[model samples]
Target: MDSFTLNKAAGAVLMVLILTMGVGIVSDIIFEPTIPGEPGYEIVLATPEDSTSEVEPEPDVVPIGERLMAASASAGENVAKKCAACHSFDQGGGNKVGPALWNVMGRKPGGLDGFGYSSAMTAYGEEKPEWTYEGMDNFLAAPKQYISGTSMGFAGLRRPEERADMIAYLRELSENPMPLPGQ
Candidate 1:
């Protein structure tokens, strides 16, 4: 309307436009769109044009079973400490609150003689076949989950390494040693 009012409004609009442009430029400079899966963004650095050598990494060679056993033995010692109250691996090992875990690797789910297995274990035994390495591994990882209604009160081992080592130690109790992975 008036010259003074129109001049002030125009100056305010110009100031706002300048501030917006300045903020946009600063934002563009500060943040890079290099995150993977985000579109229209890439990250690259300049290098010497003559550099042509490629370095290949050595492939992993250990079998899955061996790796699990190694991880188990290392983690098993610590985890088995929790099982020491009712179980023993030394001579004259007897079932306590739980069955003595000798040769449990390939044995049936509830095969221990003279020990009264819980209904859950019995059911699991009826439903499942002999405990292979993978079977035991899965069972130990989650006993209640594996059997659904077993009476073993102990919580299962959650870590892969602990299950591997515990199985390794149990296999050691047998006259024949269990072979490592890929066998």
Candidate 2:
């Protein structure tokens, strides 16, 4: 309110600021921090060219047909459960997110009439014609990779046995399941 009171308050504020600065300076001198030349831990990544360790060769890939011989439709039915969310395995089940997979084996890719197919899948169908054991196998392994622009969101079955089982189960969905490969 008055000049004396205002000056005192201003002087108190200035004194507090000076005290804080002085403490910081004195603390810095007393406890000096040693800065490292390199900040954090150095991460050494091994590139193929620089790597000296021997890389193991990939395992021998058994043919899909041979894998199918040992595959069980029951196990495949379980795997197909995931497919059930997108596709209907039963005959006349109709399309869900994906076209009904009833009798998908030997059927043309993008063959389902009612459901819309991706241009990539239509193009793939044009290229491949029908879904052969090998074609289906590859498609089941990686849908997007098999058909680059396909709308299929499924990541696909990574395990060959699981794919074979799924194919086996799908085969059974029809009136006459296609003869298993090598049968």
Candidate 3:
């Protein structure tokens, strides 16, 4: 072949190789398995099912608010631990660093006796009669946002389901536990 024809052939081959490698690299990056909690990624793997014995499925247990205190499910209890630093759930367990949370789920904000609350909580108390589920949900989602200047230093629970579970757990501690299932 002439020099110019040979050079053109070599350049075409190089271009094809570069394009092929670029596509392969892109595919690898896009298709690689990702581990869970990794930024912008998720991990998924399937394990083979056991073939020896046919195990019976456990009965579905709904977590009622009253039963949450005694039930084995740990979601609500797990979330409740976050409040232990400043609040107490046990009956007659007076205010700690924060007000006693024993029955605060339904009681009015800043209404508990002997507990000195900030102006924010007292202000919320003025307009809000009692802490219902919706009220508690809003408060727990963003404590400071709900009542600015509140003494509660907690940043607040960001997860809706987690807040719900914690509220359900708190309700279980009341003298009259509110009814809730699958909390």
Q: Which candidate number would show the highest lDDT if scored against the true structure?
A: 2
TM-score of each: 0.57, 0.69, 0.57
Error of 2 at 67 (Å): 0.6
Which stretches in model 2 have alpha-carbon errors above 4 Å? Answer: 4-59
Please give, for residues 22-140, the per-residue lDDT of candidate 3 as tens digits: 99999999999766774674566433342211122114522223333444325778888888888887889978999888877668879999999998789779888888766676677
**lDDT of each structure?**
0.68, 0.83, 0.72
Task: Please give the lDDT score for candidate 2.
Answer: 0.83
Error of 3 at 13 (Å): 72
**Winning candidate number (TM-score):** 2
Native-to-model Cα distance after best TM-score fit, residue 16 in candidate 3, in Å? 67
Model 1 lDDT, full chain set = 0.68
**Candidate 1 on 1-183: residue-level lDDT in tens?**
899999999999999999999999999899865666766757875453633222121144333376464564545666778888977665457888888776666667788887899876876677666676666766676666665656766787766656777777776766665665576
Give the worst 10-residue stretch by lDDT in candidate 2: 49-58
Candidate 1 stretches greater than 4 Å from native: 1-66, 72-75
lDDT of 2 by residue, 76-97 (tens): 9999889888888888898999
